[model samples]
Target chain A: MLDKDIKKNESADNFVLRLFVAGASANSARAISNIRSICELYLKNRYELEIVDVYQQPLLAQQEQLIALPLLIKKNPLPERRMFGDMSDLKKVLKGLGINEVI
Target chain B: MDYSAKNKSKLNVLPKTPTGISGLDDITRGGLPQGRPTLICGGAGSGKTLMSLEFIINGATKYNEPGVFMAFEEKTEELILNVASLGFDLASLIKSKKVSLDYVYVDRNDMEETGQFDLDGVFIRLGYAIDQIGAKRVVLDTIENLFSDLTNESIVRAELRRLFQWLKDKGVTAIITGEKGDKLLTRRGLEEYVSDCVIFLDHRIVNQISTRLLRVVKYRGSTHGTNEYPFLIDSDGISVLPVTSLHMDDVATSERISTGITSLDSMLGGKGFFRGSSILISGTAGTGKTNIAATFASSICDRGEKCIYFSFEESANQIVRNMRSIGLDLQKHIDAGLLEICATRPTMFGLEMHLVDMHKKVTEIKPDAVIIDPITNLVTVGSVNDVKSMLIRLIDFLQRGQITVLFTALTINKSVAEQTYEAISSLVDAWLLLRDIEFNGERNRGVYLMKSRGMKHSNQIREFIITDNGLDLVDVYLGPDGVLTGSAREAQILKEHTGDVLKGYQKTRKDREILRKKKILEATILTLKAEFESVEEELNRTYTEELLTRNILEKNRKEITNIRGTSSENNTEENGPHIET
Candidate 1:
């Protein structure tokens, strides 16, 4: 399974991510910092991140059907994935974003 | 602040919001706790979604309060389409800003949780919708889906708790639905948070019949009905039946309504039945129970009042046609809008559904009288106790509405009939038992007034007859043999009439014979008297002759009376006279 994931990762495209959060909540700030650092360390220059505050853009939250704050969605991956919570666990975030191996 | 103080000064009771669903308000004593979240838990297909939807819709349309509905399982379009079948115009309400629908899609496979989080996104979305419509009521249908979507149970629980508190702070009366758990009220124990009010719905199938029930498990700071009330989901949405008001203080009226049979009315203390009273007519099959019920119904309509007939055994047209044979024109009343006939098979619904349907009909029609043709047919769908309970509630409801009702029960036999009568007889104000009196190789109908609560009623069984003209009661003939009915009664009457004629003829003959005898005897006496007179005259003549002879011999005894004496004297004088001659 690791060899297959390595082969798929070799041909994978740029990572497109969108993080939905409330305005300056402690959890949202932690999730934003954690995901940015993880992306910069793992897939630098190969990932694009967009952050949306649900309080400012409630229509976006409604359209995206956001339930939990600090929600992150990987839009570019062939199989899109969503993660809830403040991304405190690096290993779990990497696994959820399908980063099986660290560059 | 002044209003709050006034409310507090009155009874110190918690103010409640009215949920316009039928009978639900009565059960909750008013409605759900105002400005608090009420947890509604039920199993699949137990009408949780529909109930909450109705709450929101009723609040929006009836109370002039806008509402927000957040569905977790179904999307907004699906919700609108689904409730459209129940006669709810969700789209129009949404367009008019009276209702706002938000569908929250929760898929476990699409989401992953990395660390701690709160449900602020849901709060913002819900808050936005509520603010958009200024909604006073909110519904979260099956929020248990979040438990499945999110893996961390503790976080979800904490977030849900906060969300409930936030909703309370928003001052909106909220209903949160949850799926039934194995042993708990809800799968995720949502009741632990929304503690102000908890309602449980159940759908069960007993003996091949399905029934839905609603129970108010708990209502903090207020008293509510603790019984499991049966509810129904028809085209008009869910309606709960709060069976049996514990109070027996229904007002009684002295107004009497006719039974449409004069003799029958005469048997019932010269009146038929008390208004707002329940009457039971129990009889065997083909004993004309329906005929009696139809007669009463038509009589109600004849007074320019309304009547609703619930027929379980036959269709409306069939009842009308059959009643026409006995001269009851039910169709005319139906055409005049004074009568309505509802026909359905007994097996179509469970006993409680029938009851709820009946309550709905009574509320809708507001009829003066209601007739259930052959309530015994309900026994096929439920136990005797179930039917009895249903009927008790029905009678209570109708009586409370001040509507008279008539029930026809088919009694299979004597013992069973007595059992049924004993079960229902106590609940009814009047009971008329129709029996088939089999005698002289014929079967005749006899109606007995088993009981009439508040008035004088005849105890004697009347000979019930149904003819082309209408129904009537004949006084049961008491003859030498026994109580006679049918051909036996007619035969006895005929014999008595013949005997009277014969006795009259004999009396006249004897009178004429006595007159003839008296005339003959008087004639004989007259003839005899005449004879006597003649004889007396002859004697006198003879006496006179004798006297004359004697007188010739002796100086004449001239008179007859003195002849004897004179003759004796004249004997000598007559000799002397003769010698002188």
Candidate 2:
């Protein structure tokens, strides 16, 4: 993933990341914690994470157009990736983010 | 106007505060702008204070917008308690920090002695309260209470401008209530020009119906609803539902209810009446218009929906008793909170004021069906046009809430139930005509569905009897006399009697024909019997005579041998010839 990031950077591609978080409450705090953990384990230096707090920033939340809570976005990866609900499955989240190749 | 940043750009998309009023919000496109000062100007008891109080309380409770109310009339505590009767928890909301109410008193004696007053005290109090609560909404009820006297027009005018500017500069959405005067929007009229928005509250009597009309005269920098909305205040506070007008969308309901007569329902295309429609029942006195209205009201309640009956002629108790005699158990509904009876005379107050009070009462109860027993009594205070307009306004007020309304009107002329001198027919969604027809030497009460918008109803006039159990819609009277005038049942009996007599006469004629056929068969048998007897006798006599003749011939032969055998032979031949002749 890091090698791919280096190649993408060399190509001078702009990274666009997005994350839809339902209202900023305690439930969101726990979801954000799990999202950060997944980011560090699978795509440490490969993708940029866009954390969006729907509460306090409702318009931005609407712009991302999310219906559910605690969404994680990996915009830098040519195709955007989204994982909802605390990112419980590390393997699926990594595969969805396009970082790890699973057998 | 300031579009320099994305954050500021997003603010433009927010929907305005819709006060949930009847016609007013349609005029203002929801309600006043969110963080701007809206001046409500009206005359005394014109509902300026009531409007502001209702807006503030309703916003804090309904729209999730916490508000602060600063009153210049009455003590804060008294206002709280008074509004509490209408189901507004002002005191509790204040304790919860959802709403804060403060009263600033202005005394004429104090101002007269001082001779000098500044707007600083008001500014300080309002600023402290708004910041303390971080209030997004605020109401300053009745600016008239702030002034000791309006003798100096120049000072009052200047002060009004400064006050409006301060409210705008503070960036808090405020409603400044004021007293309306004949010359200007307010006594000073200065606040009308300076405020970002101006709303006028009116209370008037037209057609015996007292109504409150709220109109926004000015709204800067925004598209607003431009119709006069009818507002109601009750135990639940204030709600303004936009009335149906010629231009807006009015969704028609396909559901219906029976006129309690199958034949009548058939005339209406098998459907009964539209849901959430207004029906007007008009007839002369003794035509049973009220009875029909009561039955409908009861039927709706029986369907598990709530109904409200406003009787301007009878007392609540009297109406209940009268309806009971006609077989409707309205008392049970009243006990269950399904039916509310409000009986008041239109003459109790001026017409406009009466409408305002009625609006308030209806809002508090929130019934699914409303019955105004007879609007004619309200005409005692107004002209025909006034009554017509008042009814239009009232219908507009309730129908917007998706509430079904049944109204009764007394016909001044006994001839026509569908009134033409009054042009309210077009305003109603449906009409029911109850009439007394004089036929077969009796007067019978019959109800016919005149029109039911968007649904079918019984077009046939149904003869309904007020039985001990209530209004019994009998089978469509199909007798030769047609729908029996209330007493036409007697004519039916008389016709039955004549039919029976004719049947008896036909039976007697059939019996006589059978007797005559029996007599003719007996005469033919007697003649045949006599002929049979004579034939038998002749056969016997012939046998005997032959025997005797034979014996005499034997003797005569012996004598003939001596006398003449030819004499005996001649006698036998003569007997044969005589028979042939």
Candidate 3:
């Protein structure tokens, strides 16, 4: 069935990613850039990135139980992954996001 | 050059924000500094939040100053409801736009630890609240809540500094409360952030009595009282009774008023107590200390001046009943709206709280005279020096206000030099010592004015009788016995009656003896007069017989010639001669 194939393709190819950061901090900027580069380089047209400023939306950050700034959450995937602290390590980021070796 | 005078002159009198608490503003020499953050640090359950909330609540109601209360620990409803017991209608105040509450809920999970964290969000919220209500007072209760979940301490410190600086820059008087630290004034060291003023509240147990004490730890630019004053958290809120007078600058009066007992007044220089002076009546139990106080209060009320009587040992009705038996109709004074009886148990409150209650009542009622019956009852709450200092403050306060105050203390033993009198002897302007003198198988009440600072008082103890007619001094011993009291007085009256009966009997006997002597003398005089008359009659009879015999003889002899005429003449001459003899 073409419908089942389309659903499977949407789940596997289309990525939902969210980035939480404090306002205008250097670490927040670095985390934002690194996460953005990773998403754009790995899944250019396949990912949907949502950037949220924690200070501006503290309630939203609280709802997500955020303890640290410059945090990233991968949604819409089979298993969700959370990464924070030293996000500049590309290998660690890729390993936490569970990216395939082909990507 | 007087350097002390120069320094005193150079002192800067800072602008103050009134706390609007009874006796608190007086102790603070106005209040906390204006446009500055004052830190109120205390242990848990020490009433830190309640005190700060009272500041804001009093600001809104009394000073007409709108306030913003940003609670870091409790919700707005909880804070409002909790302070309602203090008669602070915060909900109504907020509803009327006089008070604004913003609970800054900081969930630790959302607040991450970092090297740099600005309290800009908090400042924005507080500033918004202040602007919305046009508030002039702010209270931030508990500053440690923001860092409860934070791992880094440096950021919390920096943010606290900025927060206080921003609050001061806003030109609003603020109060910041914090938990007391073991080694520091505050757990998070918030006292360092607030540089203008710092207040420390402590809840301590002295003699098993929980007493809340408050002191101004530091006030940078103003002269404030430095004594630890006991505060009360009752239905009325925190009221601190600071040292009443820093200097004895009272304008003493030389006018004297009676103690209602004429004899006692005579003992006190015949003019009674000095107006506006504190009188201490020290006596043993049942020596009539309360009677003395009741008489004094009754006299004050009779003079058209109001008097407040505080009876810690007896209820109002009990005092009235007891005083009635002493011929002091205190109920009439109460009915006339001139006498107020405030009766409570001494163990109900500590010395400071008791003093606060007195201050509140004094301020509210504004009586011309105050009577504290048995001031010794307060000794159970504190040490000797403590009660002494409390009385000193009380006396100073009443004297400075030109209000007459009387304190009755019970001396429990024969060693008056080492008992209650020793505690308040120096503070009282006049002291009257009442004692129970037992002599000749009788106990008589005697009162002596030991000292009247500005008047000459009698040192001799005068035995006084409290009869149904009132108290009177027995000027003399009567009825072949000594001065008597109670049934002894009645027995003396009966003895005098018997003596009068004996005097009457002796008087009648002497009258009877005089009557018998007068009767005997009258009988003797009558006998002598009767004897004289009888002798005169015998002489006349004898003379008559002789004249007759002479006439017969003359007749016989004159038979021969004119004998009858001659005999008749002879007889007449003889009769007249006999009568004369």
Put down candidate 1 lDDT per residue, B1-581, tens digits, no spaces.
99988877787688798889988999998999999999999999999999999999999999999999999999899999999999999999999999999999877787778898988888999999999999999999988898888888898998898999999999999999999999999987899999999999999888798899999999999999999999999888888999867878899999999999999999889988999999999989889999999999999899999999999999999999998898888999999999999999988878999999999999999999999988888888887788898899999999999999999999986665457667988999999999999999999999999999999999999999999988999998999999899999999999999999999999989888888788788889899999999999999999998887776754333432455644555454344443433
Candidate 3 contains a number of clashing pairs equal to: 0
Best by lDDT: 1
Per-residue lDDT of model 2, residues B201-295, tens digit only: 88766545556667777887776656676565545555554443454355556667654434445666775566678888888788888887888
Q: Which candidate has the highest TM-score of all?
A: 1
lDDT tens per residue, model 3, A1-103: 4235334556775877677777777777787777788888887888877777777765554356454456677664646676654367777677767676554
**Candidate with maximal DockQ:** 1
- Considering lDDT, where higher is better, how would the candidates rank from best to worst? 1, 3, 2
Clashes within 3 Å, all models in order: 5, 34, 0
Point out the higher-scoring one by lDDT: 1 or 3.
1
The docking quality of candidate 3, as DockQ, is 0.13
Which has the better lDDT: candidate 1, or candidate 2? Answer: 1
* Chain B TM-score, candidates in order: 0.88, 0.73, 0.84
Predictions in order: lDDT: 0.89, 0.67, 0.79
> Which should have the higher DockQ, number 1 or number 3?
1
